[model samples]
Target: MTQATNDQFLLAARPVGMPKDSDWQRATPALAELADGEVRVKILYISLDPAMRGWMNDARSYVRPVAIGEVMRAGGVGVVVESKSPKFAVGAHVMGVMGVQRYWQGPAEDKGAMLAQVDPAIAPLPAWLNALGMPGMTAYFGLIEVGQPKAGETVVVSGAAGAVGMTVGQVAKHLGCRVVGIAGGEDKCRFVVEELGFDACIDYKAGPVHAGLKQHCPQGVDVYFDNVGGEILDAVLTRINMKARIVICGAISQYNATEAVKGPANYLALLVNRARMEGMLVTDYAARYPEGVATLARWMKEGSFKNREHIVEGFETFPSTLNMLFKGENLGKLVLKVADA
Candidate 1:
């Protein structure tokens, strides 16, 4: 039996550097009676990403910041307990902007915008938010469209063992590129190379990243998919081949900086080598998502892609669990389990 009252974390304050407990206000919002075209959902899992940290700030970006007094924005998976829409069936699995709450109610008119039903039969519920979801889609467009990877080329990915990084490396591998992954720990490095089939894995916490790139890609990097910004981006810039492609995805490293975000000092390498660097937003590829999802799903079916998740229990642990992303405490995707399905 689910609770009658809904638990949620609202944006209380704009975080300065790293978010603190004071940044959020927990509350119980009353569940409303179902209206026509609306569906009530019982949230099971919530995605905790480095991007969420950025959303806490008032800075201008791709989307509007989560306003103070509003429900903290989050992506989640849930079961539709009640449906007043012909579009969605009761008991159907759905994923969307379900927020940091145990329950969510939205309309069918908002499907594919705020809510969309997903098929659990295709993959596990978590995979819909991981390999088969945003992370996979981000990698597909960022690497293939922006990075333009070619066979036999040496491709490098910062945060390689992460959800988006893992997918980018594997997809580049599938395209016949030699893939190098930059991660934090030896365990993450080992798993990416041994299990995810990356050609090399660099432990950024161990030493300077340039040395790792030099050792792993002596021929020079061809396509660099950057997830962490700052120094790592500078390091990769210094090693790019002529006409090389660099794709800017997310920058987890600079998300919590008190100072202004730093641009790569070695950006001049782009001019010297005639290389190109471009930024991308996942939403920009919305129309082609079906094409991308189908391709990733097929690869998953073939055992070439690894679907990994780091799940933390308890919806009440949202604040602490979210901080895990910045500390590199989580391997692969970070998900908060709100409740049992």
Candidate 2:
């Protein structure tokens, strides 16, 4: 097969506050020839996650910052167009941290970043990277490992309609825990309770979150899976039950903060309740991803799990699609369709 150059979104400058169009540079570069054990893939759907914003800044974090002039970092689903790897064949659909680009070339040995073949029959390409993908694993491990909700316990989740939060709520419900969701709007709150099977939902935008939490979780919260940190976190911290567990997931509220991150003032509740608060990185549970995916996919097929995708039409919509997370405009897992299947 003939190799052709591809266009990619490059980081032109570090972003201050929220990123702007001027911070990115769109450039075309000649595709490198496929080397031994390497494969070339044509990217189809790119995952637009809140964590992508944190990755743009050169800060101390779980992952390295995207280098200046490099392709904007992203987790994407793609189809192999060229292959020298024995494990992967041409036409195979795969998912990986392939960045925001049309094509990718990498070695099979580099499993850390190289694309992994995805079974499109089990779930759609986009779902593999969203529901049954990184976000799904995050919700699973974060709740089970960090939150440790016992059956009949009250599980409260922030960012309830989002990819991770949605899954966390549903999984907790399936485990016999009474789930309470906190979302940005009444519509999202209704969807979380009615569709995702949460026992109750609170619209953080409608009124006081602390009151809503009190109304829904009369028994008090046993597990708090926090996604949006800030005021909501502070409110939840005050409602923790004795020996409650708090799972510190992504803090979307503070991601674009120009000011210093504000810690919850109600954190003393942990000491009073003998509770534990732990932050989790999903990558730490990478060894058990297949196990999590299998269980999630089975639940999906059995009608116990639901997966939602907020798909943007084109690659050009990437920038605006990313901003939707901060604005709470996206309903579920946000994805940009870079190419047709």
Candidate 3:
């Protein structure tokens, strides 16, 4: 056994709109030794999500903001190399909010509370943290608890081809709802419908979303799973059926707004239709995560749930890989490979 050190990506500055290269700093330091009830892990993959943008700002949120100069907060998969804990043995593969680094040192209690041992047989290590992970849970609870879709109803999801939105549509279809997705491009729209099993997919970049929705969802939307708010939210609002439910998941469209978030101009439709719209934080359903994970894993095994990942090659690409979310360059869950182990 020998001592080792690692490199980490640290937050340097908060961005006003879109994050830039200067907003991040890379630093190397000696890895700390494992203490009592602690373990040292070699991080393998880091999850890149839209919510990471909100974490960069200094403001009140469901979770604390990532402080300046700290290693940027992220979820990742890792292999334990050293363990002084009874629960986790060396060579174990686990997933947690491990930050953007090549190595992690934390108490076994901390890992036990926030992390889970991964089964590579269920799906790949990265897929568990992506499709079967937080994004999957977000889609599951957001639709079931918040949107409340019913059979024969029309369900619409914005940001349709992305991680959460894509999962939402697929789940809706599985529950016997007619699913329509709103994505940015034709290729993504094709993947959403042809690959992910949505009934229809609208290309927001190609034409008017309002018209597209009208064409696909002529019967009116029963459950609206909104992942990209702003104009698309307003457009969906106009088409809600009476007693429709709107699940306010993530609003990737407004995440980087330099200006104040604008309210939906068509909210009056909610009043007229007596529809309900509510925001949700996945952590709010923490107690029921195992239930969700069990169902998701079953779906994955049965070939009902599809897990997609767009993985970058190295830890050094963390900052740039994150920007891909805002640019709509990724087709599925985005992950950064930090190390080989």
lDDT by candidate, in order shown: 0.90, 0.90, 0.88
For model 1, the superposed segments whose C-alpha errors exceed 4 Å read 111-113
* TM-score of candidate 2 to 2 decimals: 0.98
Tens-digit per-residue lDDT, 9-128, candidate 3: 899999989999999998898887778998887889888999999999999998889999998888988888899998789989888888888887889779333867887877789887
Worst 10 residues of 3 by lDDT: 108-117
Report the Cα lDDT for residue 228, model 2: 93
Estimate the TM-score for candidate 1. Answer: 0.98
How many steric overlaps does candidate 3 have?
Answer: 0
Instruction: Write candidate 2's Cα lDDT for 143-199 as tens digits.
Output: 998888899999999999999999999999889999999999988988887888889
Please report how far candidate 1 places residue 43 from its true position, in Å.
Answer: 0.8
All candidates: TM-score? 0.98, 0.98, 0.97
Give the per-residue lDDT of model 1 (tens digit) for 219-276.
8999999999999999999899999999989889999899989989999999999999
Q: Evaluate residue 48 in candidate 2 and report its C-alpha lDDT on the 0 to 100 scale.
A: 90
**Native-referenced Cα lDDT, model 1:** 0.90
lDDT of 3 at 315: 73
Clashing pairs in 2: none
The number of clashing residue pairs in each candidate reads: 0, 0, 0
